[model samples]
Target chain A: MTARPKLVLENVSMTFQSDGKPFTALAPVDLEIPAGKFISLIGPSGCGKSTIFNIVAGLQPPSTGRVLIDGEDATGLIGRVGYMLQKDLLLPWRNVLDNVALGMEIRGVSMKEARARAMPLLERYGLGGFEYRYPGSLSGGMRQRAALLRTLLVDQDVVLLDEPFGALDAQTKSRMQEWLLQLFNDFGRTVVFVTHDVEEAVFLSDEIYVMASRPGRVIEKLPVDLPRPRDRAIVSTPRFVAMKKYCLDLLHMAEPADDLAA
Target chain B: MATKTTSLPPTRSLFTVLSLFGASDDKGRPIRKLPVRTLWSNWIIALVQLSILVTIVAGWELGATFGLIDKFFWSQPSAIFKTGVIFFTEGDAFTDIAFTFRSTLFGFFLGTTSGALLGMSFWWSRNYARIVQPYVICLESMPKLALAPLIIMVFGMGLASKVAIATALTLVVSTLTAWSGVQAVDRDQEKLFYSLGASRFQVFSKLIIPACIPWIISILRVNIGLALTGAIVGEFVSSQHGLGRTIIYAGQTYEIALVWVAVFVLSALSMVMYAAVAWLETVLRKGINQ
Candidate 1:
């Protein structure tokens, strides 16, 4: 309880003018993620979940709030936290090794040195032979792995992943979820994941932030309180089912107020 | 049995189409593609294409011999062929062909290089792109061929004017095509680069440049023909020697066979250049896609 939070968002709100009409996209929200813990933001569409990510990633400024990284008021400042989107975004012209080394390369690491640094990660993560192959030749699952490796290699203490596995098929998604939990345990980085899948949020997250839409804000922050190093078999367990059910119910209950407003 | 037979295509024909599109196995996995580019298959297509050419030439010859076609206006194939032999063997065809070839190649190299660089530089500043893009569009819409006469006047009826005209025709198109490619870069990819603390120059050089390379290479195929047309147009306006000059000279003298011979040689030369660029595109594609 006394540990310093790795990332903090205080009263973050976002508004925009859509067609000259003032639109409130995110209501004032507060969040604190502890160091080395996995946090997940799960919500319906238009829930400002990604807006928070953009804020945390330092891509956009919140209209009314501040973000703190390692207790610094790092608001709207870029490169504080590593960021990954839903797409694997590997540069098609570069091979896997070079793609994984992209963030470092951009920071002025010599290509030879970057490749040297990236080779071990590729081998450790089971991509040894594929370091020279291009992204076009890799399978969908492999591409995402390479993307995740790229984000990991950014070496930021806090990593933001926005629906990284949303595009994968069911079997691949489940497999990747388990594999991701392993990587998370190994790296021990603070991860804030955004996703629409309730099972996924429950399986990987230590605490889940369930957001509400219309006037988007974090309504409930529920801690999973499950055991660490969880397995895929837990998805079928009664406790996991109940947590998933509670999330669905919370999501459903947030919908009626929109009906009233409409 | 009747329904199945009606629903399914004949096995061999379906197999061929499926092979072209990439056939999947019974378990929905893509199969190792049968080599679609075997020489034997291409040879069959080549054979059919050759037959079409042969049929056209044979019909033209027969029509000219029977006096069904005007030999004076549309020179007979044999006469054109004979003229082509003489032109290549003994006339100044070498000089003219080389002149046109040099202008086309220089214009192609210069236009694509300059235009692609201009297009790429647009990625550096939003204000620059916004201010400059409208002018690019206006230039693209302008019929540069109409300016060939003025170009000839200014450039003084030499290879310089022809090269200038060719460059004008190709430059704007490469800029526009490459600019569109720059614009079409995946937004998410750009965001990824930004999140990595990429400087504006880093984003331009690292992400924007290589990512748009396929788009830039694709324009090479289009610009080659435009360059050729520009060269020909410049020659028509005024030039010392070129295929374009040969055609215009033959037309004025009413030597129909020489005109046809020059036309045929120009078409053959253009085809060769087109094929070379196409092969480059494929090689680059393979390298990028590896």
Candidate 2:
């Protein structure tokens, strides 16, 4: 987990033409993410966390910024980057195994080989024997797991997850966070996760970037110093509560004063 | 609704047992060994419906036989049935039916294929959509029957004119359906395909096609009926042979029974085509969902 910065966004900015008017979604920003680290970007709605993630994934061009990968200019790294959107976005017609193998299929891997690689991950990730089921049959949590496996099956080093559990039930969301932290620790993959939930940012990420609304820019970066192999009980710890408070205060989100973050 | 409730209690047991045995009730009844009383009641209900139909037919036959109504103006069912017998046995009506069937089917094929291809092409390129969309609108809005005489004059009063008319009707419907189907696909689905590293062509081929198939199949089922109408209309306007021409010929000779026979044949053909398309749609949906 101590590798050099795998992805660096230098002075990245985004502007969109909405109804013939220029709307700046993200102001100029600079960030560097090291390899094998889990980073969360938390912000209000319409904040540019998604815009920034999209730019990094090569899905959209930054108005002004240079994205570098491994100290080299990454002007063309579209296929090399893996992304999971807020929506599960699973193809309803496709079975779980095929959905996960879609990335390989596009990369020209034969069907047999793609399935062989995707099936094991499905089984290992608590989706065993459910490979043949369609997306419509899976619950929200199961679907999100299938989606993560899809992103992982692409075998890309840098993964962008945009509120992957935003649509889950509260209990399921907590379980998923612990599960993801364990998986991240095992795989040692660099991840940039975006979420509106402050406690989730503190629970799953090593560093949390709190963003402000309207022309979204990163205002604060808080580091979580928790030990590895985090579990659900970590939320009850004093440090976890303190870190979540700091993030909530930074975002200025109004809420009932509760120690649930603890 | 009240009838449905009263009927349910008696048949419930029979249905449960028959369902396990893999039997389907079409006339709303299946053989049940233990539910003999329920089975007899089911037959009673069927008999009542059958009696209603028989009474109506009997009254119609009696009126024509007794000259209570002018049989020369509107023939009886028996007269129509007699004409149908001649049609099947003498081979005279078969030739006419075959003529109309061939022309209409050809037109249907031409219209649907061209329409679907054009619709897909338009969807793929906005520039093409912009350019050709107005022309399509004008063509679709135009009264197509007015063009039939000119079509006959140009293509000659042969099978081609009938085919052209049918094609004209079918093509518009197909194009519109295909375009709307393509547009109705979920945006998230498209993004899903793209994130999988699918190229533009692959996205269109895999995601777009599969999502729109149900819509396309529904359009096809509708087009089958439209194709038959188009063919009949074409035959009525200008054709030397076919069911439409036979109707015209019978009307001129005051042979009302023959005209009624042609009408029934046309309707029966449409019904058959509709059934076939419905069966195909079911099979296709099963395969896609699976």
- Candidate with top lDDT is 1
Per-prediction DockQ: 0.59, 0.34
lDDT of 2 at B254: 94
Two-chain complex of model 1, DockQ on C-alpha atoms against the true structure: 0.59
Error of 2 at A190 (Å): 1.0
Error of 1 at A231 (Å): 2.6
TM-score, one value per model: 0.86, 0.87
Per-residue lDDT for A28-66 in model 2, tens only? 988989888899999877779888877877777789988
lDDT, candidate 2, B138-185, per-residue tens: 988998877888888888888988888889888988888788888887
**lDDT score, residue B205, model 2?**
78
Interface RMSD values for all candidates: 1.1, 1.7
Docking class of 2: acceptable
Give all candidates' CA lDDT scores.
Answer: 0.90, 0.83
